[model samples]
Target: MSISSAAPPKPTQVLPYATKDLHEVYTLGTKLGQGQFATTYLCTHNTTGETYACKSIPKNKLLFKEDYDCVWREIRIMQHLSELPKIVKFHDAYEDSFFVHLVMELCEGGELFDRIVQKGYYSEQEAVKLVKNIVEAVQDCHSLGVMHRDLKPENLVFDTVEDDADLKIVDFGLSVFYKPGEIFSDVVGSPYYVAPEVLNKHYGPEADLWSVGVISYIILSGVPPFWADTEKGIFAQISHGILDFQSEPWPVISDSAKDLIRKMLDRNPGKRFTAHQVLSHPWIVDDNIAPNKPLGV
Candidate 1:
């Protein structure tokens, strides 16, 4: 007797957060952005007529169990921080055989980095305000037990095109829920913003503050503190942790600002300032300092 051999059928991937049919609720429109795993679109509610940004991830892209888990974790993290004013609000999620749709608040003002760059020259007062919002968001995330592994200018956006628009944090794809003192070994984060300890393959929430410091440095100086042509070189410089405050803008930059950056960017994660500490620092809290002088680009 001859027996035929065949492989067993794979289990179906299911997304718990996605229940409703996406097409039934919202009309997916123009493409906003595209990433490796998902494509974001301008979507409008069919009934309410409200507009939103919908990130649609195709099922085929989830080639592994870890990919699906990452998607689920992102949805959970967004929902966990939904109430935060600085975080992009997660409205709903939907799933079908083909895709998983995530509906979120629409940020029409483009990226925070773009807005700052367009302004050409901004004062320390302006930079302080922007950094304050970012640090406050970080503090909130930490307090809620979420670590945003990726924190960079591109991830920060303005809710509207208006001058007074609120800066909202977006893209929690790399974030994870962590307990106090829990160490993560994964080297996950943008090259320029990533902390040295992250490169060392061991880090905690303090890594976020290091990114914040890199952002602070960029906002004040219009350039990244660590610079190199290649990713490897960049990582090397970040590992070295030497900050350049001798550049054109740094000479005029306030001492208080530099002090805060020094504290936040400390090579030793233990010595790095917590989000709360950065928020409470005199440079961040006191309005009297952080001069209003325009930092020339």
Candidate 2:
């Protein structure tokens, strides 16, 4: 359906919309996923028969009151990048008296982490392809001045379960748009993947690259580069930027791959490679090169 038929969508929250209007335009289906403040459902347009992922956020949640603007920002960011490759599509945001609805592209495959675990073992070539798609998605967002503060395995999904399906980056709840040279102050993102600057509450886009580096380490090694028995321990390890390559997988992985991860996980934000640089790095762009003999994955 031409979203033109319904009331024009707003980038931010509007007054409670009519429940009837929602039912009139789209047929809601099964529950697809859940979050801290909302649940996503499968839905189809009444006229267009187009399928979409609808995130439903309850108005009564305390989180809604605190991060109301963040929700709107997430919607707007998705809207801005809807047409960009490797980024999840955003169709619309609808609100009623009780809840807000976010319609977006449906990612059918499971999380990248889950897929890797299921596959049991993955090659360096496979990791390279996955990282390329992920970097391109982040690069697109960075080009638009948007920072996906939270980029983890849970947020990366494939279009389908097919072997060659394209990967997509999703979830922009912690994202924020900023001007060049401006420093972001909010401390956000999962502890393990967060950049050192974020821990100090002073950071920028490079902070996100650090997260990609964390993810790169996990995908390639079949395990996280940093870990501890407790949350405090994990954060401490992250702060120190200590990673061990003595494990079985580490010894077998190619030197170039390890080099790229090190560059991305650099303690100094100034030295960390940006998304563009990561995409062009020798490890990521070189196809003929083979990975380590025993891909711990």
Off by over 4 Å in 2: 1-20, 62-66, 292-294
**Estimated TM-score per prediction?**
0.94, 0.90
Clashing pairs in 2: 121-297
Location of the lowest summed lDDT over 10 successive residues in candidate 2: 7-16
Measured by TM-score, the strongest candidate is 1
**Pairing residues by index, what is the TM-score of model 2?**
0.90
* Candidate 2 residue lDDT tens string, 1-297: 555565333333433333345777899999988988789899999999989889887766733334666676777888888898788888888787677788899988878987887887778888888888899988988898898999999999998899898889888888888788879888899978888899888999999899999999888776788888887888888888468877877877888888999999998899999998898889888877656343753
Best by lDDT: 1
Worst 10 residues of 1 by lDDT: 9-18
The Cα error of candidate 2 at residue 19, in Å, is 9.0
Model 1 C-alpha lDDT per residue in residues 1-297, reported as the tens digit of each score: 998886444334647543878898899999999987789999999999999999999988877677788988999999999999999999988889989888999999999889997878899999999999999989989999999999999899999999888888899999999999999999999999999999999999999999999999999988899989999999999988478889788898899999999999999999889988998999989999988878884
Q: Give me the displacement of residue 28 in model 2, in angstroms.
A: 1.9
